[model samples]
Target: MEEFNWLQLLNPEFYILLELGGVKIGLFVVLFIVFAETGLLAGFFLPGDSLLFLAGIYSEGLMNQFSTHNDFLNVTIFALLVSLMGILGNMTSYWFGAKSGGYLYSRQDSFFYKKKYLYQSKEFFEKYGSKAIVFARFLPVVRTFAPVIAGIVEMDKKKFMLYNILGSLLWSFSMIFSGHYLHAFFLNEFGVDLKHYIEYIVIIIVLFTTVPVLWKILKKQAHIEE
Candidate 1:
């Protein structure tokens, strides 16, 4: 049997094609991926922002496969569902942290578990408080661990929920809808089909979001050495 290439699953292009092909299973796959990325510690490596954006771009294709009419309403509904999935994923993460965070924190780092990630997440949560949940949504690794940190810190549930909902809505709507509309604008204005540029676009988006986090880490390390 051939080994399953988990790396291929991380590529947004894989999900983009599935979504564009109107594979009904694509919807569930996308939702499951979003949920696991935010909710599971093992999911830190999964693509989040890029997948959302690509889903937006190919949303019309997915809709057209199901509905006879192409309209903005379908896109809006799809974005809403995606946003809700993100929120639920964070909520699940929060619950897991609330349940087992202390036990995990007490253990030594192992091959599969790194205590440093939790420490970094703890510092981020302490520095930003409830706002970290919102800001982390735009960040890559931080977003995956922020909810767990919040739970570990025993942040108020009601407050966490408020920020979680706000962050998920903003992150999901902005990425997905922007991709959907931007694809339309580029095609209509410059007669350029954005699909051909999806790989480049995804790279740019990943770098745009990731560079700030790297810079902050570097600056903090430098300050520590000083």
Candidate 2:
């Protein structure tokens, strides 16, 4: 894993091979990744926002990689498709929680599994409601766990999906097209090019998202000791 770009694992070439290997893998990787991020307990570290943003940016370079159409229209279509994939993934995760999270919360469960990660998310949902879905979509770690927690805590499915779709659309497309278009706009504006700006943009997004999480963590710790 250290030797791999890991990030490139999400590239179109990788997806083509996933298809060739008989996975019927039409955006399923993106689907699963988003689902795991939203629903699975330990998936918060996965790069949901950055990945979508970068996927949009890389689609132009990957036209030949997947032997697909090279135009922005095709790229936009693909990005939107995957954005829907991500939303559906979260819905599946919600379904998973609705189906099984109850059992995990019942008397048969052990303390570690019952008292740890799952309950934290449950508390977050209990405290926030539908607003949690929107706010959590922007937060990295909590975003991954929020929707599933929403399901486990018995959030209204219709309302959850509504918020999930809205947030996913904005989060996925805004970052993706903004990076793609803005990078192009800036490069074309300068005499030559400023391609390295993409890396800066990603850093800014990550730091911008992560700071609040860090703040919340520190705030909670301080309250605990007081």
Encode model 1's per-residue lDDT on 23-138: one tens digit a residue: 45566677777788777665556788888888888887656555537568878777788888889999988998888858868879765467777777778888998999999888
The window of 10 residues in a row where model 2 has the poorest summed lDDT is: 107-116
Which pairs clash inside model 2?
A: none
Task: Give the poorly placed runs of model 2, Cα more than 4 Å off.
Answer: 1-32, 39-42, 63-72, 102-120, 191-199
Local distance difference test, per candidate? 0.82, 0.64
Runs in model 1 with CA error above 4 Å?
1-7, 19-24, 64-70, 106-113
Candidate 2 yields a Cα-based lDDT of 0.64
TM-score of each: 0.89, 0.73
